[model samples]
Target: MEQLATFGAGCFWGVEALFAEQQGVTSTTVGYMGGHTPRVTYNDICQGDTGHAEVVQICFNDSVITYSQLLQLFWQNHNPTTPNQQGPDFGTQYRSVVFYHDQSQQQQAVEMRQTLNNMGLFKAPVITIIEAANQYHLAEDYHQQYLLKRGKASCSL
Candidate 1:
């Protein structure tokens, strides 16, 4: 069966583009999560008051790509130590996070992060959040796959 994983690295554009090309990912959706409001706009997320992070939800076939594989990709794609920033994007809304749907995912995220830390893979400590799935508000159509069709989309992770 297909399962879901949610992550917030930075601008959803590049993140979505990167993951959409990964093997075993059934689909990807850009959205906002870890916010108080049920429906938050992109502008509001940019403002940071919404407490929402621009996130991507990946639907992948577990048989093809394990959750651990996705975690590795997440670690490789963005800077997790900077705290609320990736590449040029700087704000709380761009914080690095991994939203897990269950205990297995939670354990995997935690273990993978710990392994990275032990391996000194990151120059600084990782700040990626491993939390329960929060309300995920889908982004507008234009923001869905901004980088695939548009070449000059946000390059921030």
Candidate 2:
């Protein structure tokens, strides 16, 4: 079966690129999520006042890649310990978050985060938020597969 997973970890450009290269990730859409705006744009998110985070919504085949494995990638790819920030990006839009689509996903997200915390994986506490999936407004066309289109492997900060 296919499943949906949404995450906000730094720039969506790199995040989308990373997942796009993953084995089971069938598709990815860079977007804005966990916000109140009805029709948010990349500009609005950049302002950092929309309560939205730059996120990538991924569709994956569970048979090939477990949600737990995806969670591990999420934890490993970004610094979840920093609140409302990641690398050179600093704002709520860059916050680390996991948007669970179902009760099972919710449980998994919570447990994974807790496990990382218990392990003291970082010098500081992990502040990544585990929240219910919210409205995901797809970003402009130019934003999708940005790295790939530009022939760049990743976002440079």
Q: Which candidate number has the best TM-score?
A: 2
- Stretches of model 1 off by over 4 angstroms after superposition: 151-157
lDDT value for model 1: 0.89
What local distance difference test score does each model get?
0.89, 0.93
- Give me the displacement of residue 106 in model 2, in angstroms: 0.6
TM-score of each: 0.94, 0.98
Which regions of candidate 2 are displaced past 4 Å? none
Q: How do the residues 84-125 of candidate 1 rate in per-residue lDDT, one tens digit apiece?
A: 888878998999999999999999999999888888988898
Residues 21-134 of candidate 2: C-alpha lDDT, one tens digit per residue: 999999999999999888999999889889999999999999999999999999999999999888988999999999999999999999988998999978988899999998
